[model samples]
Target: MSLLSFRVEQGDISRGCGFRSCCWTISRAVISSGILFRKKNQVKKGCSSVNDDLFVITDAPIHPEEVSAKVESRDAGAVTIFCGTVREWTKGRRTLYLEYQAYESMAVKKLAEIGGQVQDKWPAAKVAITHRVGRLEISDLAVVIAVSSPHRKAAYEANEYVIEQIKKVVPIWKKEHWEDGEQWIGDQLQQVEYPDGKPMKGSGTDD
Candidate 1:
């Protein structure tokens, strides 16, 4: 498993412990199923070279260390890594598996866009993001974002910014393969279930 995969299992299980007591570990074991934003006052003209290290979509598992290494400069004192992994349950729903499909080029561009946004706020920070496409099993690493900076605060903030923007703008579709049924739905948490699990009108298809 990659470092990102490891961090995800560790962090999410810790969070799951709050939701479940004795079964917390089991609940986390099932994480085949499942942050913040900032304001942009102005538009940027072009993408940033800072993201050239990555901002990608791949079928292979993500390596968090590789992403983190992109920002590992002598100038960087802190590196904050955020790993988004596939979990077992979402809103009491039992997800057997998940299929992640994406408009690959579009998704990659959006990730680069997020990197540009991060540079706007935290100029000293460097970011690398990798989101796996195709099918992902429970506890699989879905996305891994690594941000490094001279200080820890900037790394943390930039890492969060990139993750949130990917959710909002990246043209990546995830279908929840649940025990009851599968649904190509919105929201990673399964909070928004459209009628018949189709995209909302004017929302476009998952095609």
Candidate 2:
């Protein structure tokens, strides 16, 4: 198993690093995948304001209601949510579980970028995205996406768009474990692979 290492920025104390002694607490979960291990507070990035708009990457459990509340608004007639979960089966294989990892900094950046794109395409829409990275058991929520818009049509469309863009752009990778074995399966689009045994740093497809 491999773990992606991060160089904590000298001043990003919000990321748990700085002149202070506080730092991100690492998860004790064993590194069981060739992809990466899930660590507590390993990587976290998101909005720094009071608005509903947000983007986050973390190793914590994601709650749909919490995420949906972030994007809730009286003006928004419709609020759409998309929850991605770990399934027990894929193809013909009975999956045991899944391990997810990401290039945290870049993944959050891309997620924010996708949010920008959503707002650009649907100017009246507000979006919030929370993607969990780490070990996920069958039926566990891996991601919670919420999009609110003035109209239901716009909300649905924007919500779908966010996920599609995430698959194409976000640097999050999933390793599937089945009864047989496990492997570092690449992006959702199947357009990228970690042939060298790990994601390529600073690359869009590195996830």
Candidate 3:
């Protein structure tokens, strides 16, 4: 996996010249044979993380039930599952579909990183997160997060925390296929705080 270099200036994030390297790893996993393959299922290719906590980035379709099963246990009286999907409309544009990519190694590591934060924040919560890469049609499942805890509130809060963290720190990128054309977007949720300039938020055919 290649390291990403970005600088913060004037309270905005700007990408480094090696910016191309950011998605270079993603190309190998998602752009096989010049095609972007996004299955309706979660794609499982390698070991997920430091724990058997089920944090993964895949091309296969995500099944919430399966993810939930992995984290659910008798010690947990409450189980919360959050599924993120591709919406037909984002901002004002109508997207036909979306293709996602990621720095696989770093992505899973960051996922586990989020898992660590969740456990620390909610001692009783158990968390599992799965993300899919490749082409996804509108309304297709993009992410599944499972959090189980003895208290319902802990499970709920941990679930939200993991999702926000993934969108902020993960290496996953997406291309919005609009009715007119397609463009590669930055991070999972760019609308959020971009402390620095958001250079990767532009759209173009030239990757």
Candidate 4:
């Protein structure tokens, strides 16, 4: 169980910080003993779980309706779903399509761990996560996460947790294609911070 460290921006974890905080407290010993534990926790906190009911694909486009169906379970009282769409701007750059890549096996394994963690933390009915790879146009669905629970709050929190954890832990890479050119953003492995307590900027890759 070697922990990976990552630098996270302040607001980056807004949606799922609560879940991250809870998990971090329980895993503090594991985190504290590892080099770059804070940073790794940041990354882990950002990513969605691989194991649960989640799915990651580098294939063609993803169907939201299908994903929604997969997230449905008889025991669930509520299900929260989140989708990431490819946008046209990044850091003020005019972006074109995006090309996503991932170490598939590792990414899925990590996601499953996240699902298990969510279930342990809350009364989860079901959880599903899916990510798209390959080239994607603007407005294309990049990621989708759904969580079912006995109540709305649990579903909401679990849903938020899944996306944040995905951003942190999954070995997925994205190349931002701009009209001028393209650059590949690598995996995040550091946790740099500002002096005034403000949040940090974009994440870095493990390249």
Candidate 5:
């Protein structure tokens, strides 16, 4: 039986205490549905609780340790943290700095969705992702991702998977401030280009 698979009887729900009340202790339950019902931002254990996942699109400088702490769990034997920083150059062009922007609401939603996918694939893993927007100087931390799991392999794989998935799905863009001029990188992969010098239009205002 998977740790996430559990059936909360009607009586259990009526008690106002469901899966989260004993997240770590109910691993031996039956496997029917692989969903773990948890409070909106938290998972409770006994009398205490911690954020189940952290997903944010912020304008402030991101602290890696702070993001990592969100996923810490006594059941996790390994936690993998990944920090992405602005580089000084891209290809042969020298970059002075970089500016990042995102459709904040949707980007955050996509981040949480990615976290949910991670949990589905690695049931024992918990993930947190924080991406910074606004201007970033050389070597500035742009994104931080942390994943904790009962083993190192799942933690490492899940952390790498999150970053790649974010790039492919999240609506976050970056502009390179070159020595000569600036260009909006429509897609982080650089496959899509914006001739008008803006992010690709979509839902929500890019703030």
Candidate 6:
């Protein structure tokens, strides 16, 4: 299976463990479960797992400096950061804004789980992630990830891993607001379900 596919399945189970417990479990699983198992050829190419910390937020702009500070400490010799910003275009469509909704409690819990996995997968100095919710306009800050390690390579790898994992597992829904109309992104990450015995409006049509 692809890396993302494996993560989607295992991540679903890990998210169920609640915030604190999930973190510990993810940490253990990454080390023992071979989630980042590299092939012999990949290992020869010097490939390894990345480690990072995650921060998730809703309806708030993310400050990179704040996340960097949180991930940095005396022991960390290098820090890497990534910031995701809202853009006006997606897939050739003009996006006016984005409306984000999430299962807040579960989202936070899942973020903690990702952080723990980072710690276990590599000798990460520290990791932090933050996500914004509510309506976001073009150029608005949406998400931030920061990682620190004893070397530049580890920091870079961890930063990449955390962002990819969030896209796969975090229980956040995104609605694309366009001039023509609004369409919710109901991908594999966010399944659509309606109330019992009720037919959802626009259920069949692409909104």
Alpha-carbon TM-score of each model against the true structure: 0.70, 0.71, 0.68, 0.65, 0.72, 0.64
What lDDT score is found at residue 32 in candidate 3? 25
Question: What is the per-residue lDDT of model 1 for residues 50-110, given as tens digits with 9 covering 90 to 100?
Answer: 2365676777776665555555566676667677777788768887877877766667777
lDDT digits (tens) for residues 1-207 of candidate 6: 333442211111122110101111112122233444332112110121122323456465655655555654556656666667666765567888877766666667778888889899875557877777778888776666767777766776777788668767766666777888776663313334332422233333222
User: How much RMSD separates candidate 6 from the native structure?
Assistant: 15.3
Better of 1 and 3 by TM-score: 1
Report the alpha-carbon TM-score of model 4 versus the true structure.
0.65
Residues 66-177, model 4: lDDT tens digits: 4545555556555555667776765567787877777767777777777788878885556766777777788887776756666766776787678767778767766667
The residue-by-residue lDDT of candidate 2 on 85-109, one tens digit each, is 7767666778888888887777877
- What is the descending TM-score order? 5, 2, 1, 3, 4, 6
Candidate scoring better on lDDT of 3 and 5: 5
- The true-versus-predicted C-alpha distance at residue 37 of model 1, in Å, is 30
Provide the lowest-lDDT 10-residue window in model 2.
Answer: 12-21
Instruction: Assess each prediction's global lDDT (C-alpha) against the native.
Output: 0.60, 0.64, 0.61, 0.56, 0.64, 0.56
- For candidate 2, what's the RMSD? 16.1
Considering only N, C-alpha and C atoms within 3 Å, which residue pairs clash in candidate 2?
none
Q: lDDT of candidate 2?
A: 0.64
The residue ranges of model 2 lying beyond 4 angstroms of the native Cα positions read: 1-53, 191-196, 203-207
Q: How many pairs of residues collide in model 6?
A: 8
Which should have the higher TM-score, number 1 or number 4? Answer: 1
